[model samples]
Target chain A: MRNMAKGSFKVQVLQAREGAIVASVNRLLAEKGYDAMTVDEVAADVGIAKASLYKHFTSKEELAAAAMIRLLDHALAFLATLEAQPKATALERLKAVARWTLQVQLAGEMPALPAQNSTLRAALAANKTYLDRLMLVSDKLGEWITAGQKASQLNRKLPPELILYTLFARACDPVLSLLKAGGKYSDEQIVDLLLTTCFDGLCGHAKLRLA
Target chain B: MRNMAKGSFKVQVLQAREGAIVASVNRLLAEKGYDAMTVDEVAADVGIAKASLYKHFTSKEELAAAAMIRLLDHALAFLATLEAQPKATALERLKAVARWTLQVQLAGEMPALPAQNSTLRAALAANKTYLDRLMLVSDKLGEWITAGQKASQLNRKLPPELILYTLFARACDPVLSLLKAGGKYSDEQIVDLLLTTCFDGLCGHAKLRLA
Candidate 1:
């Protein structure tokens, strides 16, 4: 029993260290994106030896995959809360997810999802947890999108996949960073503006002056 | 007079080689993005020796910047054409530029502009021709945005800079590629759909079923 307790304690410490490493990877990705992030730097950021870092992640690809998995996990958790909100409209839920993405991006916690990095793409494709959670998030969003389309809340003409990809792209939308760099708006204001633009677009209604 | 002709011929050859190098860099950046692209690969693709390639572009950053300058030049050229169309509305001109961006991107001629590559950013910042032309492009677009707002064509509530960035962002928009990847849409269809989304947005209008 004592040996088992000691073993449990060791496992806890290992898991805790791994969590810290993933956090550093996430932050580095958020700051400089995958191309600029270095494994040695991640190790240094986490106050671990390079060998120890390798013991956990093994490769930069794996490190990125882990961070992405964490992000997807957060997304899935957020989706779950929205799923429970029985009173919310489908479009309202979609907006909530978009809002969450902007908030995460503003807080510097969102990883810049690599659009064309082949290695990172391969790593993510092979990551079961990442793919599973991504699918879950997509599936959840897909449901809302279909519902919104049926209700005429979202344009039914667009493929639901386009809507999903557009919302996902919002997580790394350069407009957020540009607005942040301008120092003209608070984070709340920035999120609201992007949310409006994402759903309504750049058109003028002449009446409300917003689409 | 004979010597001057020979020197001019030599200069033409040098210019031709530089153009080939920049084209290769542009294609590679489009295919692999800035992070996956390398100086060696560019040299190889250009059918030149690494040493010879260095004679044209000193570094990868410089090469990327040159490609960006080429892209900006194309954009300026396109804008000039739009400016000459005196009968077009400000909104029509904006849509033309947006369509041109989508077409250029689909043709694989557009360089993936690095959003956070610090080295590339520094090189672009230091390039006077690039900065000047970028400013020109921005100024032209800014004028259209102002005119459109005044005409009640574009949303007056949104800032003009946001409109400009949103349109610029369309050049690198992942939605176009995603839709293409789904293999259901033609190039013309892709450009038109993206252009409509850029101008009208994703909101379903009870009237047109698009914002």
Candidate 2:
């Protein structure tokens, strides 16, 4: 009984340590970006030695992949929560996702890393686990796009892939953080403005009337 | 008379060599990006020894800066050409610039380089030659935006900076090339669709006229 209890305690402690390392990595990636981040820095941030970080993930590539996978999981989980909400329209869900994305970015919880690192891009491409989750989220959003189009909530002429890319663009939408940090507008005001600019079109009623 | 002719010929040759170096750097920066591009490859591409390349630009940063300054010059020059054209509306001139930018990117001439290099960013920020041209273009566009709003062609609620950034966003707009290259849409079709998307809202009828 004693041995079992000791084993259980060890497992829990290992899980806690792993979680800590991932959290630290996410924070670093958000703050400094992937190209500038190093394994030793993540290890040091987590109060673990470099070797111990290697024990968790053998390489910086793997560490970054793991961090990205965790984010994907969070995204999927957010979608699930939205799904559980009763009678949400496809457009509502998309706005929810966009809102959540903005909130994450504002909180600095997002790994707002650049997509310029070839090695990291390759790692992500080869990552079946990450790739699978990414594709799944993609499909979910694609469904909304199709549904919205059919319901005439979306422009039928506009391609779904284009919509997807625009949403992805919002992640790095420098305008969000720029406006928030500029202190010219409140956070809610900024979010509302972006949502309007993104969805309802930037043209005033006169231009809209022509279309 | 012969010696004077030879000296003038030598000066022309030197100018050509500098132009070749700048062109090669731009190509490499586009392909491998700034972080991965090397001086050795640039020297080889320019058909010059590494020493010769260094003689022209003492460091890689200087070489990159020269390439960027050259691009800014191209943009300013294009704006100048547009200014010479009479009877063009603000929107018409804006669209002309947008088309020219897209054409440059399609021809593989536009430098949509990612912002990964802090040193390059610092250099650009301090670069009076580049900043002067950038600000001139920006101020000119800002005037058009204000006029566009006053003329009821633009959304007055949206700030001028947002409009300016939206147009600038096209230079780096990944969707334009990605969808075109995806083979789903022809270049002409892609450009038209993107142009429409930019000026008008995505909603074909606008203002939630889903029916």
Candidate 3:
């Protein structure tokens, strides 16, 4: 009984430490961006030695992958919640994802990695757990896109994947930050404008000749 | 007479060397990104010593600035050519810019630098020459946007700057390369899809509600 209790305590401590490390790395990455944030800084923030940090993740690339995996998990969870709400339409779901992603950025929870690293790209590509959640979310969004197009709620000419990339680009788009930094619009106003631009035709009500 | 000719020849040789250094740096920067590319490698690629390379641009930052300045100059010239065309509408002008930009990228003439620099935000901001040209092009684009909105050609509900950024993002958007690299679409098809997404409502022919 004593040994079991001791093992349980050890497991809890390990889990707590791992959680702290993930949170610390995320904060550092968001603040300093991927290129500037070092593993030692992450370890220091987590109150662990660099060696302990290494024991958890082999390199900075892996740590970034883990952080992204967490983000994907959160996104999946958000999608599940939205799915459970039967009142939501397909366009509503996509808008919800965009709004949540913008909110995350505003809340300082967004990752700042530039997505330009070859090694990091390889790691993310090979990360099955992350890829699975990404695909699940992607597939859900893809269906919504197709449904919207069929219903004439979305554009039919554009491919679903192109639409997906445009939506994904919203998360890391520099314009959001630029607008925020300029203090030109309140957060609510910015989100509203962006949402309008994303779904509704930016052309308002104009009719153009079809070639 | 011989001395004057020799002096002019020397000037031409120096100009050629400077252009070569810039090209070498641009190539290496695109291949390895900003942080990974070394000045020595650039020098080696140009068949010159590191000291000789520094004679053209004092530092890596300066070399990069020169490259970016040249790119901006190219953009300005392209806009000039478009403006000179008598029958160009605002949409036609915008499309002309996009087409030229893609052609430049396809030709391997565009410098893929600003995305990787942490200091670029401040560096470019402090750079008077860059700022002047940037603002000039920005103003030119802004006028077109307002004209577009006024002509009932663009969606007035959306901000002009946002539209401008969206267009700029197209030049460097990774999606074009990704789709092309996937072997799924020809370069022409990819560019056409992107241009369509940019101008026409991605939502197809459906009437859009902005409110």
Candidate 4:
């Protein structure tokens, strides 16, 4: 029983250390992006030795993948909370997810990955945990999207994948950072404005309503 | 007179070579983004010595700035042509610009820049030619945005900068590449679909129109 207890305590400590490493990697990725962020910087940020950092994550790509997996897990948990809110419409839930992504971006927590990096893409594709969480999140969002379409909330003319991609695109939308940099609006206002454009578009809302 | 004619021919050849270099840089930027694209790669793509390429553009950032300047020039020229039409509505013109950007992105001509690169930002800022062309393009688009808002063709509640950023965001919108990668939609279909989402949004157009 004492050996089992000691083993459990070791697992917890290792898990905590891994979590701290991921959190540091997430911040560095957000600040300098993947290319500019070095493993040494991540190690320094985590206050750990380079060898110890490598013990947790084999490569920078793995570090990024871990950060993404953590983000996806957070998103999955958020979806669960939204799922519990039975009163929210499918479209409302979709908007809430988008709002959460934008808020994370505004708070400098969203790691903006380079879309064109094939090596990173290969790593992400090979990482089973990342792929699983991504698919899980995609599946949940897909359900909401289909429901929204069925309820005539989302555009039925557009394909479900297009809508899904649009929502995912909101996570790295440059408009959030640009507006945030402009410093004229609060974080809530930035999310609301982008949410409007994402849903309502640039057209006159009154004109569309009147039409 | 003969010497002067030879000088003119030499200048034209130099200009053409510079154009080819910029074109190669543009394609590389689009394919790999800024961080992944190397000056050596740019030189090799242009079939020139790295030292020779440096003679035309001092640094990689200058190469990127030149590509952006060329793109802005193309946009400005397109805006001029649209201006001459005189019959296009402000909203229609804005949509045309957005469509053009989307089309360029689909064609893999759009140079995707890193939004968070401070050094690149400083280089671009210090580049008078790039900054001037950027301002010119922004001012032209800003006019259309203001006109659209004034004519009640765009959402008045949203700031003009928000609308401007939205249009800019469409150029690098991941939806274009994602949909393209899916191989389910034709390029024209992709552009039309994104344009619809950009202007009308993700909401049911029928509901908005019927309302």
Candidate 5:
């Protein structure tokens, strides 16, 4: 019984260390982005040696994947809570997801990965946990989008994937950072303004014509 | 007279080489983004030795700034053309600028800079030519924005700078490339779809509420 107890304690300690490593990685990715972030920085941030970090994550791509997985997991949990709230319209649910992403970004937790990095893309694609969680989030958002369209809350003509990419783009939007850097608006105000632009656009009932 | 003619020929050759270098930098910046791009790749792309490239631009940041200055010069020229248009409304002129940026991006001539890079920002901030040209472009766009708002052609409640930033953000919008990658739409179709999303938004006269 004592041996089993000691083994369980060892596992618990290992899990806690792993969690700390991932958290440090998440912050580094947010601050420096994937390309600028080094494994050395991640190790130092976690108060561990580089060798030990390698024991947990083999490469910079793996570290990024771990960070993204944690973020997606949080997103999944947020979606579940939204799902639990009965009687909310699909548009409201979608907006909630948008707002949540903005809040996370404002809190400096969003990892801004470059979209065109092939090796990073390969790493993410190979990561079952990351891909699965991302698909879950995408699928949930897709459902809300379709329902909103059917109900005339969203523009029925816009493709669902376009809408999805727009919302995803918002999570890393330079406007939020620009507004923040300007020191002109509170976080809440910035969120409200960007949210409006994301949904209502800048035209505001004006008829749009090609240039 | 012979010596003067030879000097003029040398100057023209140097200018042509510099222009080629800047064009290569612009394309690489578009494809790989600023962080993932390296001086080695740039030198290789331009078919010049690293030392020879350094004779033209001192650092990677300078290379990026040179590309940006070139881009802004083109923007200024485009703005001049738009300004010369006899009867285009402020809204139409603004849309013309939007469409022009989208076209440049589609043509892979847009240099995608990282908004958060302090060194690059410092380089740009210190570049009088770049700053002057950028200011000219922004001031022109700002005038159109206020005019549009005043005429009630745009959302009156949204700030002019907000509108300016929104339009600027669309130049680098990931949605364009995402749609292009999907292969379901022609380039014209993709631009039109994105143009609608940029102006009409996804809501399409639908009201938005916070989640």
Candidate 6:
């Protein structure tokens, strides 16, 4: 029993260390981006030896994938909270998800991965954990999107894939950072303005107001 | 007279070579981004020795800045064409510019720069030619945005800076590439769909149509 208890404690410590490493990778990736971030910097940020980090994750690509997986996990948790809100419409839930993404990006927690990095793309594709979480999130969001469309909340003329990609694209939208840098608006205001432009569009709302 | 002719011919050749170098840099920056792109690759792509390339532009950042300047020049030229029309509304002209930016990006002519790179940002800031063209384009676009607002063609509630950044953001929007990658839509269809979303928005148009 004592040996089992000691083994459990060791596992918990290892998990905690791995979590710390992933968190550091997430922050560094968010700050410098994947191309500028290095494994040495990540190790330094985590206050661990490079060899120790290597033991936890084999490569920078793996570190990135781990960060992405963690992000997806957080996203799934957020989705669960939205799912529990029984009064929210399908479109409302999707907007909430988008709002959450923008808020996270504003808070400097979203890892800014390049959409066109071949090596990193390959690594993400090969990562089972990352792929699974991504698919799971997509599936959940997909359900809400179709529901939104059926309820005539989202545009039925647009394909579901387009809507899905647009939502995913919001996580790294440069407009958030640009507006944030402008310093004229609060974080809530930034998200609200972007959310307004995003769903209602720049001209659409104006036209509607006129009509 | 003979010496003058020879000098003119030499100048034309040098101009052509510099243009070729900037073109290669633009393509490399689009394909590999700024961080992954290297001087060696740019020189190799341009079919010049690294030393010869450096003789024209002193640094990689200069090459990027030159490409950006060229792009701005092209934009200014396009805006001039729109101005010549004189029949298009400010909103229509703005939409045309957004479409052109998306088309350039889809054609892989857009140079993708890191928004947070201090060294490159410093170099660009120091570049008088780049800054001048950027301001020229912004001034032209700013006119249209305000006109659109005054004419009630754009959302008055949103700031002009938000509209300006939103249009600029469309150049690097991931949704354009994602839809392109899906291979289900033609370039025109992709541009049209995105333009629809940009102006009319997802929720607003569907609601308008339903109403």
C-alpha RMSD values across all candidates: 2.8, 4.4, 4.8, 3.1, 4.7, 2.9
Model 3 residue A107 CA deviation (Å) reads: 2.3
What does the lDDT come to for candidate 3?
A: 0.75
Instruction: List runs of model 1 lying over 4 Å from the truth.
Output: A1-7, A206-211, B1-7, B206-211
Better of 1 and 3 by TM-score: 1
- In terms of docking quality, model 4 is medium
iRMSD value for model 4? 3.1
**Per-residue lDDT of B1-211 in model 3, one digit per residue for the tens?**
5647557777888888888887777776666666667888888899988998877877788777767776778799989887898788887787778777776766666666644356865677677888888888888888888888888777776768777876676666666666666776667767776666556645545422211
- DockQ, model 2, C-alpha based: 0.38
Give fnat (model 6).
Answer: 0.77
lDDT of 5 by residue, B1-211 (tens): 5647557777889989999999999999998888888999999998999999999998999999999989989989999999998799998998888888999999987898887677888998998988898899999999999999899888888878889998998788998998888998777777777777777778875322211
**Model 1 complex DockQ against the native:** 0.60
Candidate 6: tens digits of C-alpha lDDT, residues B1-211: 5647557777889989999999999999888888889999988999989999989999989999999998999999999999999889999999999999999998999999988788999999999999999999999999999999999899888889999999999989999988998999989889888887888777755432223
Listed in order, each prediction's TM-score against the native is 0.94, 0.87, 0.89, 0.94, 0.93, 0.95
> How big is the positional error of residue B123 in model 5, measured in Å on the Cα after superposition?
1.4
DockQ scores of the candidates:
0.60, 0.38, 0.40, 0.60, 0.48, 0.60
Off by over 4 Å in 5: A1-7, A205-211, B1-7, B205-211
lDDT of 4 by residue, A1-211 (tens): 5547457777889989999999998998888888889999999999999999989888989999999999998999999999999999999999999999998888889997899899999999999999899999999999999999999899998889999999999989999889988999888878888888889888838332223
Candidate 4: residue pairs that collide: none
lDDT of 2 by residue, A130-199 (tens): 8998899999899988998888876787778877877766776767755765688767767666666666
DockQ winner between 2 and 4, please give it: 4
State the weakest 10-residue window (summed lDDT) of model 1 chain B: B202-211
How well does candidate 6 reproduce the true complex, by DockQ?
0.60
Return the TM-score for candidate 3, rounded to 2 decimals: 0.89
